[model samples]
Target: VLFMGITFVADGFGIVATDVPTTKTVVAQVASTVFGPDSLGYFSFQGFTALILFLAANTSFNAFPRLAAILAEDGYMPRHFAFRGDRLAFTLGIVLLGAISAGLVALFQGDTTRLIPLYSVGVFVSFTISQAGMVRHWRAERSAGWRRRAAVNALGAVLTGVVSIVVLLGKAPESLLVAIIIPILVGLMLFIHREYGAQARELEVRPEIVVGPPHRRERVVVPVPALTRAVVQAVNFGRSISDDVICVHVTDDAEAGERLRERFERQMPGVPFVIVESPFRSLVRPFVAYLDVTGTKDPEAITLVVLPEYVPRHWWDRILYNQVTNQLKRALLGRPNTVVSTVPYRRES
Candidate 1:
C-alpha cells in the first residue's frame, strides 16, 4: 500500500510517466524527486531499489532448478539434471539456466524493450498452465466446494490465457519465436520420454535370470588408416585387451591396401590384417558395413573397435586433420554390443 501511494505521488509529481529517459530508471527518478538528489532518503531508496532488482534476478535461480529436477525425474530431461551438488543444489540446472539467461541477454544486446515481451508471454503462459492444472486437480478430487475452487481456477486460466494471446499478438514477430519454440520444446520432451521408456525396457532386469558360462572372448578390431606410431599404440592397447586383435584398413586403391597389408605383416607379425575395398572412396559407411557383417557373423563375441587418433601439438592445428575417429565413434554409437575406443597419440612438436 505504501509503495502504491509512493507511485501515485511520484506520478502526481510528474516523475513516473512523464519525460522519463528510460522506464528502468523511473524508480531512481522518483527517489531523486521526492527527496533531494544528494539526500540520504534518496540514496536509501536507490539502495532498496537495487536490492529489489537483485531479488528479481535471483527468482529463476530458486525456481528453475527444482522445475528441471522434476522434469528429469519424469524422464523429460537428462538424468544428470536430477543430481544435486555438495550443497544439495541442482548445480547443472543453475549453470545451464545462467548460461541461457546470459545468452538471451547477449542476443538482445540487453534491450529490455525487446526482452520484456518474451518474458511477459512466458509468465502468462506459465500462469495459464498452473491455473488450468489446479482446475484439473480440483475436478479430479471433487471434494466439498470443489466447484467453487475449480471455477476460480478456471477464471484465472481464462484470464491468463487471454492475456497470453494479447501479449503474443501485440509483440508480433518477437513473440512468434515463443510460439514456434514452445512446440519444438514440447516435441523434444516427448521424444526424450519415449527414448527413456525404450531404454528402460531394453535394460530392465528380470527374475528369470540364469547363470551362464563366462564368455571371455572379445574381438578387438583396430581401424588403421596407415601403419603409423598412433596405429601401433592402438594395436598394442587392443592386444593387451584381447588376443583376437585384428587391423582393418579400408581403401579405394587396391595397391595402397596391399602395401599397408605388407607393412602391417612386417611390423606386427602374427596379427591378422583385413583389407576392406571401397570403390566409392567413402570411409565411415564402408567401415560400419564391415563391422555389421562381422557382428552378424559372430553375435556372441563383443566387438571392440579401437580407433587410433593423432593429437596435434597445437590446438589450432586440429582443424587441419579430418576427425575420422569422431565420425566412426558417432556412426557405431548405437551398434549392439560394440565398444568404440580412441587411443590419442599426441605429437611431440
Candidate 2:
C-alpha cells in the first residue's frame, strides 16, 4: 500500500520522468537532486543496496538463530548454540552468522546487487521445500477435518515450487550461478555431516562409557610459559585444584632457556622450572611427552594443563600474532588422561 501510494505520488508529480529507460536512472536523478550530483548512478544503487542489506541483516541476526534453535532442538546443530546468552541473544548463532556474512561481503566486495540473485534463489528454494514439508506433515495427520488443511498445503507447495522453477529459469542465465551452486553444495555437506554424526553415535562406546561414573580427579601438571601475570594467574588457578603443579617451559636454544630459568627463579621463587629441549622448535611435542611420562609414572592421577592465553579485543590484534594458544589447545586434546583449561586475560585497550 505504501509503495503503491509512493508510485501514485511520483506519477502525479513531474519528479519521476516517464521517458527514463530504467528505474536506476530515475533513482539516480532523484538521489542526485536531493543529496548531490556526485551521489548518482552506481553510488545511488550502492546506497539503496546498502539499505536493503541492512534490513536483511536482521534476518540472519534474528530469524536465522530462531530457525537454528528449532533445528538444534531436532538434533541438527549443537545444543549449546540454542541457549540464550546474558544479553538475551543467541550469541553463538549471531557470531557464526556475522562471520559468514562478513566473509560473503568481503568475497563479493560488498556489492549486494551481485549477491541478491544468489540470495533470492536460496529464499525461493527454502520456501518451496517448507511448503512441501507442510503438505507432507498435513497429509500424515490424516483426519476427516484435515482434508481442507492438506488441500491448502498442497496448493501452497505447487505455487511455491512453480515460483522456484520460474526464478531458476529466469535468473540462472543472469548472475545466479552462485545461487544454484552454493545451495546444492551446502545441502550435500549437510547431508554428509548428518550421516557422519549418526554413524558416529551408532558406533559409540556402549553402557561402559555412557552409564558409568566419571573418573576420579588425578594429578594436574600445569605448564607455565614464564613468570608473567598471566602465568601467575594460571599457576594459582591450577594450585587451587591440585598441589601437584609442575611448570614446564620448552626452549629451542639452551642459552635462552638458561636466561629464562634465572628470570623465573627470581620472579617465581619456589616454583621449579623444568626445561624441555626441542631441536625441531616444536612447542607441543615436549609438553605432550611430559604429560605421557607423568601419566606413566602415576596412572591414577589426572593431568590438568592450565594454559594462560591473551585474548585480543580487536580482530586486527589476532592477525599480528601466530595463534600459538589455539594450536597448543588442539595438541593437548589429542593426549590421553589430560584436561586442558585456558585462563584468558583480555589485552588492555
Q: Pick the candidate with the highest TM-score.
A: 1
Candidate 1's C-alpha runs over 4 A off are 11-26, 37-40, 83-92, 99-114, 141-152, 162-181, 206-218, 223-243, 248-270, 273-302, 308-338, 343-349
- The alpha-carbon deviation from the true structure for residue 235 of candidate 1, after best TM-score superposition, in angstroms, is 4.7
Mind giving the per-residue lDDT tens digits that candidate 1 earns over 215-250? 746999998899888889999999998899989999
Look at candidate 2 and tell me the lDDT of residue 54: 86
Predicted candidate 2 versus true structure: per-residue lDDT over 233-340, tens digit per residue: 888887788766778888788888888889988877776678988889888878788777767877876788888877777788787643777777888876666788
Model 2 residue 46 lDDT?
Answer: 61
lDDT of prediction 2 = 0.73
Cα lDDT listed for each candidate: 0.89, 0.73
Model 2 regions lying over 4 Å from their true place? 1-62, 77-124, 175-182, 185-217, 224-284, 297-301, 307-330, 342-349
Per-model TM-score versus the true fold? 0.68, 0.55
